[model samples]
Target chain A: MIADLLTTVLVLAGLAFFAAGTLGLLRFPDVYTRLHALTKADNLGLGLVVLGLMLQAEGPAMIFKLALIWVLVLAAGATAAHMVAQRTWTHGEFERRE
Target chain B: MNLLLVAAAGFLLLTILFGLIRVLRGPGSGDRMLTAQLFGTSGVGILLLLGFALDQPALVDVALVFALLAVVAAVAFVRQHGLPEPAGTPMHENPVEEQPHDPPHNPPEDTHDR
Candidate 1:
């Protein structure tokens, strides 16, 4: 019962973060700031979701797999964020359309 | 629990839908690419929720693949699109530029007479 409750709470929180991240992406002024919002919020959201799922995993192996997925995403998201930021820094901000 | 998971997944889907507006109205390609990243992360969340809610472990593997592929897509975007840097700007502000090397340490000039 406790496990299920925890899962519900964690998953809901994760979804909230996802919503915020998307909102930032759509509304933020520029690419660099949007990258800040998207990369950080989304990854943390995914991590929370993974943690919630881990509680309900079938076995040790399943738990490990979920953890692995989260770790891979964390690493990949960081690298991709850096690359995008560097590209934007060098190339300059894209002109905004009125 | 199952219903909750399913509902959460649906919510994530909604977020992804909202992200699409950014893609369509992108003032820059980078903005579009960021939406793709949003899709990838949200897609993983949905797959995982569905995997547990529906009792299909195989869906977890699919989520794993989704995570991997998102990075690949980002890499491809960076490689394929080479936006022109602003005019008259230095190519890069590398750290090497911060240090001034002694003239003696520089490569020796060729001294052979013609």
Candidate 2:
């Protein structure tokens, strides 16, 4: 019962973060800031969701796989964020088209 | 518990839908790509939730693949377009000073060679 309760709270928290991230992505003024919003919030949200899921996993192997997915996402998200920021920094921001 | 998981997954799908608005209104390619990244992460969350809610372990493997592909898509975007300008271009305030020992101008040459 406790496990289920914790999962509910954690997963709901994760969903909140995902909503904030998407809001930031849509509302931010520029690419760099949007990158900041999307990458950090989304990955953290995924981590929390993964943590919640881990509690319900059937075995150690399943738990390990969940952890692995979170780590992979962290690495990939960081790298992609850096590359996008670098590209924007060097090439200049592209103008918004109406 | 299962209903909670399924609801969470549905909520995540809603977030993805919101992200698509950014893709449509985004000022630049980077912004659109960011939406794609958002989709990738959110998709993983949805799959995991559904897998547990529906009792299908195979969806976890699909989540694993989604995580891998997101980065690959970003890398490909960076490589295929919007590369930095040549060192001496007016884009940078002090390109030469910033990169004094930079390697020979090679992007164009490399493209030609390709």
Candidate 3:
């Protein structure tokens, strides 16, 4: 019972971080800042939530799945953010901003 | 457990809203691209939450593929069409600083559009 409660608390806390990240992504200016916000919170937030849930989960199968999801989050986040930033580079959108 | 999953999914939905707003009202194609990235993140969250609810491991494989695909598509598009610049943006700040540093870009007229 205590463990479940603790995990619940942790999950909720992670969710809060996710919320803050989303807000930062929306409220911040420019692609870099947006990417900065999105990557920080989304990655950590999801990671924590999965960790917290892993406590409640049973068996190696569940644990493996959770871990795989985290790996995907990390890999995908960097690549996509990079692509967006790359687009900004190729388009010469920066010159005018200068 | 069910209630917690539901709550988590709801919060994930909120993240979706933030991304969608960018898609709809973003100043340019690049902005829209960023918003689209949000969808992929939210989708991952949703997948995990669902897997937890169902106690299913197979879904994780699907999520993995989806995540990879989204990033690949984003990168391919960015490399191909170029990022769309937001209108009314200042012409003095070098926006390309956020990008990978490489090569010289030939100067061109400011093609500002709405």
Off by over 4 Å in 2: A94-98, B85-114
Q: Summarize candidate 3's per-residue lDDT along A1-98 as a digit string, tens digits.
A: 88678778877877877787778767777767777877865588788878877887778887777787778778877888887877776665652221
Best by TM-score: 2
Report the Cα lDDT for residue B6, model 1. 94
Candidate with maximal lDDT:
2
Please give the distance, in angstroms, between residue A20's alpha carbon in candidate 2 and its true position after superposition.
0.4
lDDT of 2 by residue, B68-97 (tens): 777999999987677844444454454454
Candidate 1: where are CA atoms >4 Å away? B83-114
- TM-score of candidate 1 versus the correct structure, residues matched by position: 0.83
Model 2 iRMS: 1.3
Better structure of 1 and 2 per lDDT: 2
Ranking by lDDT: 2, 1, 3
DockQ of each: 0.63, 0.67, 0.37
Query: Candidate 1's residue-wise lDDT over B44-104, tens digit each?
Result: 9999999999999999999999887778988887765764433333533545434666545
Superposed Cα deviation of residue B57, candidate 3 (Å)? 4.1
Clashes of 3: 6
Off by over 4 Å in 3: A94-98, B83-114
Put down candidate 1 lDDT per residue, A7-52, tens digits, no spaces.
9889988887898899889778888878988975557899899999
* Model 2, CA-based lDDT: 0.83
Clashing pairs in 3: A96-B91, A97-B92, A97-B93, A98-B91, A98-B92, A98-B93
Instruction: Kindly indicate the candidate among 1 and 2 with the higher DockQ.
Output: 2
